[model samples]
Target: MTVFGCRSCDATLTVPVSRVALPVHADQKYGNRPGSLAPALEPGTFAVNPLPSGPPWRRWAELEPGEAEALGWYAPRIRISAGPVGQVLLAPGDVRGAVIDPALVSDSACCGIDGGEPNMVCATCGTPVAIRIDDCGLRQAVWLAPLTTHVIGDDLGPHPVLDWADLIDHRPGIPPSEPGGGWHPMWAAAAGAALAHLLATSGGEPIVIPDHQVADVFRPTLDRLAGPGRTGPERTLVLAGPGLPDADGDLALIPQHPQTGELWPVAPPVRPVPLAWDAWRHLAFHRAPKPVGRSVPIPPEAPLALLPGPRFEPDGQIFLSVLARLPEVGQPWLRAIYDRGRPYSYTFHVF
Candidate 1:
């Protein structure tokens, strides 16, 4: 767990927290319909959003020459944040030794705070140091004011990035289905992020993903997104991971390292698309070895299992959020899709 300190007093500002990659969809609305939005990072963890975010956004034309590209904006943006850089994000509940500044909170926003400025202050120095956001219809997170905090230390000594072989043995899996019977939120996100890569690498050609569950998750949208016929041969995407055979398809679906966020490297010509670790593990290794085509009859006393819902929609927000970051978005073909906001318009239900 890493610790952060208030820049003003050199006093500790946060509890020791594990660091994680900010979710690609962190800025995009998820769980915004028919339910409340949860905090971006879970308790005891934090991440840095490398991109500028929140308030005082700058229009593309307003950007000074060379400013946009330096900030990693390769393509034209309708509007981009000119706010604090490298904002630290964590659960609102995770904040410690701080108080919400009622004066800075937005009264017009419903449910809870939608802080654009510093709403959280250091308990010791009374300096405005963080922002707490919990607007009802939007995602909730506490973002530390950029210049107000500094790294103190990491409580977890020498955290090691696991080897792929070790990860297979130790890492836990995320359920594809949740207790209440819809696609698990993590599954929707994993599929959505991976789907963006599939489209980018598809070369605007038809893609064929053949693993039963893999195809089941991605095939519907792939068919829908492919435009009318060209006699071109199809492209295949197949699972590739540690302890699994080398992927023979045109594209290999691999797992990103849970701790390090590194992709399992593959050699030339076979393009790699990464899926979040737990999600990939669940898909690849969740099934135990069993006899094929040997059906077992259900016992008379057995309880029925809840089957998955017929429609499995990947969150479109997750798709577009990730697609916007990829270098492929600069291509004219993919650029058109990004500019048009395909995900928002597509009928496949976005979470």
Candidate 2:
């Protein structure tokens, strides 16, 4: 348990928190609705993205030569974040003594904040401490400003108890949709990050997921991107984890523990594609009995009842951003995907 306190006033600001890996989709922007996405990190958890993020933007042209390489971007972006590294990201609910100031919000965003500027101020001293972003199309998060806060307690006791087998007994079953049954942004974010990994090691051969529910989300885009294979079935990826039979396929979709961020162990020769815990859990139990409902039919010309979210386009930024960072990205075949690939943007839907 680490307690974060304001550097200026030394006031306690955050609940006891444990460190976890920065999620591959940490910065992902999902459906264009405020509060639509889950908190970037779970409560009682935090992550430090050593990579530079946040404001003080620099256009690609304006940057000095080699600046892009310095910032960990292998491919070009329209604009890049030139802010300081070591920013602390955790759920806003974990914050204890800070209140959001509407006036301090970054104006680049319309509905809520974009998080480049400080929106959270210390209640005791009014020192700018963090920024809260809960906007349409962006993640709902609170980023503790660099150097504004520090950890005062370090007694995080008995953490990382989520062993591979323990998760099944401890965590509740994960349903595919959010609380009222709509496409989950976490799913979109997970798909984006996992697709990058799937493509990176794919040798450009078409990807095949045996899980029918997961296949609906990834297989179509993968088929188009990697191609339908020149020869017969090359390999297949199937959901795999503790208490489940080993997949006979070439690849396994495995869980990265939510608390520790370590991928579940798999036997060698079976490559692993890491999905966040929730995503892995959902796919692992996709066959669990679910309530079935009858649908109300509407004319083809009539509009669907809802238009709350953007159509199912996987988060391209997450796809490319993650692809660019993979150690295997140097491979020529994998380089083409993030460097100059259209497969991520092709119109597709899995919902």
Candidate 3:
């Protein structure tokens, strides 16, 4: 159990938080539809993570090299894939005297709850200490502000990244979709971010993505971005990870250690570029989203257990942090891809 306290007055804002399984979809939106499932984390467990919220960030170009490193290389770029899933979570009841900032409230919020914004405050000192997201048809929980709230308790430390072999065999259940119909938000976000990396891997050349479900989600973006008369360096985005067969021919974007956010280093250190965490996982594991609007009974012997992976966005702050540390950070095309994503928005439209 952990205690989340105000950094200013040391006021105990919350306590006794146990870690829980991170949700499958960090950007999940339980619309007006009824019968949404319960919170992702159980009553006591919670994860601590930094998000794209709080103060507006300065652009990477605006900062000096030393200043950029000091700020953790997290530019103010927005449209992240999902929130960071860390070994941190606190129960709602454990939170005490924490108040919500009215201005942060969203009109689209369910029952006055903001999904993941820093809308929560410490009652004692009135500091924005956390983010409370308990909207209807959505998960209910709190994400403590890393700058304002400190955790006090036993630190269980970081978990190991799921091996590619383990992940290939392990598949999680599908998330409840938005009422109308569409691919999972996490999948879309992953595809969007992956497309960004695919472009980077191509070195501004024309590339091809094979047909199928993954292509279905990603083709539109690629075609739209690289339509007629557009020509340069390009490469194919293929299925190659830790467990799968070795990638042959053209280059591949490999997986990252989910827990440490470390990109899998390709041997010989040439070709096979590194993509963000969730982007690689989406290709390595979540390539096919489960069929929505239906249920099928599984035999008891079937390996239907969901693996432990947090709701993730490849473009999330964590991904950008890792990218900032890489040699390709200076590449003009990569910078353009990152900049192409809208500011402060989660959705990306190629057209």
Question: For this target, which candidate reaches the highest TM-score against the unseen true structure?
Answer: 1
Model 2 misplaced stretches (Cα beyond 4 Å): 34-36, 62-67, 157-160, 229-233, 288-313, 330-336, 339-351
lDDT tens per residue, model 2, 1-351? 878889998999998888877876677777566454668777888888797777788877788887878888665566778888888988888899999887887778867677677899999999999988878777678888886888878885325556777877776445546667676667767778888888776656656665566676676667655555345457788888877788677888888887677888789888888888877776675453333573865434432222123344466667777876666777776666555644234442322
Tens digit of lDDT per residue, candidate 1, span 141-174? 7888887887888767234457889989887767
Ranking by TM-score: 1, 2, 3
**Could you tally the backbone clashes for each prediction?**
0, 2, 15
**Who is ahead in lDDT, 1 or 2?**
1
Give the distance in Å from residue 3's predicted Cα in candidate 2 to where it truly belongs. Answer: 0.7
Task: State, as a TM-score between 0 and 1, how close model 2 is to the true structure.
Answer: 0.80
Score candidate 3 by lDDT: 0.53
Q: Which is the winner by TM-score between candidate 2 and candidate 3? A: 2
**Which candidate has the highest lDDT of all?**
1
Worst 10 residues of 2 by lDDT: 302-311
